[model samples]
Target: MAEPILKWAGGKRQLLDELYARFPASYGRYHEPFVGGGALFFDLEPADAAINDANPRLIGFYERVRDEPEALIERLEAFDDPDADPDPSLPYHEETARGRDVESYYYQQRARFNRRPYEGAFDPLEEAALLLYLNRTCYNGLYRENADGGFNVPAGRYANPDWVQRDRIRRASDVLAEAAIRNDDFAYVLDAADPGDLVYFDPPYEPMSATASFNEYSADGFDREDQRRLLDVASELDEAGVRVVLSNSGVMYEPYADAGFRVETEDATRAINSDPDSRDAVDEIVATNVPPEDRGSAGQRELSGF
Candidate 1:
């Protein structure tokens, strides 16, 4: 199986079992609008699928991964030299190591990435490489943005940061080859999905609490309105007889229960919290119209006990 290439903020690796149990045995096609780490999409490796993200750069990165895996791999390998000079003075993995400052390198690349020639001119390959590198080295593997649309996540502490995985990249390329990748609003899935297809909406979730929010994946964070819009879309899909599954914060999504979707909560391990101490497990809402017969038994079994 192909693993997720990037360590995304709301990546669903921890919730894979729960998501999997809710998946239909089979469907006409697969649709994932908020393809972050794309944990479930990559796992299913569906032949006819459409994966999308609100972030254009993220979609561009996926394009590069699919179309130029070898070139991306070559560029990513050059970044493997974490700290060559060995600044024996700094503590191990603390800010600076070897003589080179890892944090400095991260910020420098971020500046380069934000520095567009004009408004939107950029080299896709380079941006993709920088995006991947920054995500791997950033705090909590988050790709956050500032109000000015700049990549602003601070550098993380990693003794030996490894962001280059040749086999994984190649595997992902194979999986994406047959899929239609797009950069668009989540609602685009509505026009593209058919009745028998499966649509999974893992939109940026509402925060568990004030201290637990990390929704700034873009300049304008996904707020209450976006959550409501997503619910509407999911409800539409459900009514169309499309298999609909959605995941969001446990707190604000009780409204989904009123929408007639089966709303359930499961403990999901989340690491993207401002307070490191609180980055443990939290209840996450998983609403779906998938029938119990269509869903696999294992995830239901594990979640029932959980």
Candidate 2:
């Protein structure tokens, strides 16, 4: 299966099996309203899919990957090209003892990305490439934006990171060829979805505690109001005969349960945790309108005899 192009903070890479089991056996169209990283979407690779995200630049990156894979790969190659004379503008964090000014190079690229020209010189293609590079090399591979919608992530210290994922990008492009990319609110799925289709809602998770909030993948943090609004949307989709499946933090237990859906908690991997020892697994709530009988046990099949 093709991998996700970006390393999104709350990405659903670890929940793939749980998600697939609960998915409708058959559906007309696939919709991911909050398509961050889209690990499951890449795994499923539905032919007629519509994926949207609040991050306009992320959406643009997907569009670029789908339409201009060659161009994207070319730029990535330029970023990874060690043989070529290093451009004074772009930064390459060298791992060897002959170390370059790592922080200086990374922040410089970050500034260039934030101050990208809209029309004349620096094109959208370059901007998209920079986004990929930044996400790959940034601290913990986390894509966190500042209040001004600027990309404000520090550089990661890696010996030799796969900064240029040429094959991965090519594979992702092939998969996204079938998907319609969008840059809009998650509510856009309501109008785009039809009966017999499927919509998976993986919104910014409800924080477990006031101090534990990590929903700032974008500038505008997802609040409790947004969470409630999403639940309403899910209910509307359920009523319209569209299959609805959602994943959120454990704090959403009451709300999702009250909405008359099958709610189950599964241990999922959290890739970006400050406490290194605490990065194993956390209980995440998975609520879906897919009938209990229809949904299979992802874990049961793994047993030698079941």
Candidate 3:
């Protein structure tokens, strides 16, 4: 089954075509070092692929979907009725808004999320439902943490945001079932790559402009050192004949170019910060190891069955 198309923050659904255009006609296997949303993974539909993330909960959700898709689907489908009332019984809003002692509050919500019955707590079918819920309903969809390593984002503005994409989740699970899911630091997956493997890196953007940064995807911040390490990995992969595509804030391309990667820039608009004022245009870059000759000359390229 084809992977379901999902709407997720940092998802590359919009750039799938553009990224695919740069991929070679064929590759031995696919690898994603930081598979945040799995947008590119599902889009490419590689027969054999390795998808890894540092977030254990996120990866566990993916594994659950793959192993018990029916249960997950049933949980998500319960939210489908248009007239269903939002679960106001929960104190997620009040607890999240009073952010003074946010760590406790955030974990309380996480505990609530983890403890609820399959129907009330979380829907198994829509693996994305919990992700989307925490993303939209939580502080800023900004997966952040306090000094103690607890999620600390405040509640968001969406009163009853739609949290389930039943069919899409099913599809995404289908795709995930065939791929290997790993929960580890990015290096472990990158090191596992073989010659001709394709790796796509979507690390947190290094905030360039005053208003254009969101480097706090996890409690452990991805700093400049991490960025440099990623570049080094890309270089090592290139030397090993592995194709690498990296997306990041456009400001870092000069360093990447210095590392011998061919950099291509594009303008991208995203709604990131919870504030409406923060949702504006931004420039992003796609640095690649694929040879220029192999890239599509025109529109987005389709690389799945190539």
Candidate 4:
């Protein structure tokens, strides 16, 4: 199976089994409005699907991946050159080994990526390569932008951070071949999804606590109002006979349940916390349009058991 191309903050790789178990045996086209990292998308590899996100850079990257994987890989190969001179005194990856300025190259690349011309169409190849490099080398693989919509995550301290995977990119291109990728609001999925189609909503979750809140996936962070709007859209999809599934912080279960959806709690490890001690298991909910037949087994499984 093709793996996720990026290291997204709230990626669902850990919960794949639970998600698969809850999914219908088979369905029509797949729809993921909030396609961060796309762990499940790559896993399912649906022939016909509609994937979307509000992040234009991310959408552009995927579009390029679908249309020009070979070109992206060719550009990404530059990072793997062990002897490539990023500076006179050091190779890009050999800086720490040579006892020279180790982080300067990373910072320079970060600055270059941030300084990319945001006017007209974003540079697909350059932005995509920069995004791949930063996520691999940045602290905790977090993608955060400043108020001016610039990529601003600081460089991480990996002795030798892994660069792009050639094979994975080709595999992802095959999966996205028959899909319609879009950069649009999550609610706009209603236009593409027909009855019997599956739509998964992995929105920026509600904050469980003040210190634990890390919703800055974009400059326009997901707020309570966005959550409310998503709930409304999910409800409308359910009424239209579309199969809807969503993942969010456990605190936002009332509205989903009140909307007549079945909600199940699962333990998820919050791995992106700055404080290492706080990277503990937290509660997350999986809400589905159809009540799970195994509702009686909900309490049988521990929150972290998945």
Candidate 5:
């Protein structure tokens, strides 16, 4: 299966089995609004998909992959070349990794990325290349933005890092051709989804405890209010006869239960945690409106073992 190129915090790579188990056996278009690290989207590789995120650079990168795979690959190749001539405009980091200094290289790219005018014309290839580089080299592959709307994750020291996966990139690009990617609020799915369509909401999880809050991913952080709003949207979709599945903190599933949604719990280890000792498995919830019996033929057989 094609995989996400960027290392996204709260990415759902490990929970794929649980998600697949609960997914409707058959459905129409697939919609994922908080498509971070798109573990589900790429794994499913649905023929018709509407994937979106609030991050513009991310959307632009996906667009480049879908419309300009060759160009994106070429730019990534250039970034991967350690001996390639350096441009004066882009600075390299002082710290050396794998016999190469990349601290300045990372910062320079980060600065340039933040400098790009949001509404102005810019090269999509550059945006894609920088995002890939930062994601690969940044701390735990986390994509945390500052309140000023700048990429601020520190560089991760890796003697030998896997910076480029050309085949994977090409594969993702090919799969993305069947998707409609957008940079919009999660609610945008409301207008895009129809009855029988499946919508998967993977919003930033509501903190399960006082010390576990990692909700400040985007500049406009997702809070409890946003969680309630999302529930409202999911209810609307559920009432409209649309298939809706979602993942969030296990504790947060209480709200889903209260709303009359089916909730299942799974244990997931956080991939981006800085403290190794604190990386133990935590409870995550997979709530859906599609019951096992109504999961169509495929879901029926797949869920039979349960």
Candidate 6:
């Protein structure tokens, strides 16, 4: 099975088992346009897949793993001493904040990540490690940034964090080797689907309440315009006979109802965030263009199991 490459803010790791139960027992090829944590991709282990994300760094990491897993592993191994302090405030922190040199910025970010309360600069590999490290250690594993694309989240309180999951990384690398990883706009992926292809989308949730919506997957946010574009894409894919399953905020269903799709609401609890008040269970939607035979089975199974 594949593991998630990044510790994403709103990853679907908890939903994978239930979601897979609803998928067609057999399908042609698997495609994940918004491949955040890739919980589903890893869990399903599809033979043919086109996994993609809008985050360039994420795509770069996956590509590197496919071509140079050992190198990435070595870098990760260097961070194994979780208690070792490496200076949290590095030069790249200021550089990234200023939108100066991104490569140098990332390197510095990694050094800070290695040292709790970071204090020095880092290299590219270390930066990647820091990214993963912060994701694992931050509040709810959420990755939020300022308008300028700098990493701005504060550290979380974890007594012990799995700084390096060597086995999981190796497994993830093996799983990714068989898939094609791409860094592109989500439409590029949706448009590439052929008939019989299965596409799973987990876009940023449309906010249910004014305070609930957050879209930091990329430096630029996915605004209402992006949502409309995604709905249009769903229409196109539905017409082409491609299986499409989506997860988003329940609030979006009212607007998306005209797209000829089915919508179901599920209860979800927030796992990443600093405030305990924001951790309560809330309603989320599962929208899909798949036929009835291919939908809702997993929901039923989950309810039955509970």
Q: Could you estimate the TM-score for every candidate?
A: 0.87, 0.88, 0.77, 0.86, 0.88, 0.81
TM-score for candidate 1, residues paired by index: 0.87
- For every candidate in turn, the CA RMSD to the true structure comes to 5.8, 5.5, 5.9, 5.7, 5.2, 5.6
Per-candidate local distance difference test: 0.78, 0.78, 0.65, 0.77, 0.78, 0.67
Instruction: Tell me how candidate 5 scores on lDDT.
Output: 0.78
lDDT per residue for candidate 1 within 63-180, as digits (tens), equals: 9999999999998887644334323342323332123334455655655566442245578998898888878777777788777777777778777777776887899999999899
- lDDT by residue (9-103, candidate 5, tens digit) is 88777787777777787888999999987777877778999999988888988888888888877777766433233456453344222233444
Question: Tens digits of per-residue lDDT for model 3 on 172-235?
Answer: 7778777899988888855789987788899888778877556555657688788888777788
Give the alpha carbon lDDT tens digit for every residue of 230-304 in model 6: 888887888888888888877887765667787777777765657868777767777776666765443321111
Give the lowest summed-lDDT range of ten residues in model 6: 297-306
Cα miss at 101, model 4 (Å)? 14
Off by over 4 Å in 3: 1-7, 76-132, 139-142, 210-212, 296-306
Which is the winner by lDDT between candidate 3 and candidate 4?
Answer: 4
Predicted structure with the largest TM-score when compared to the true one: 5
Q: Rank the candidates by TM-score, best first.
A: 5, 2, 1, 4, 6, 3
State the lDDT of candidate 4 residue by residue for 191-231, as single tens digits.
Answer: 88999889999999998987667877777788889999999
Residue 260 CA error for candidate 5 (Å)? 0.5
Evaluation by TM-score, superior candidate among 4 and 6: 4
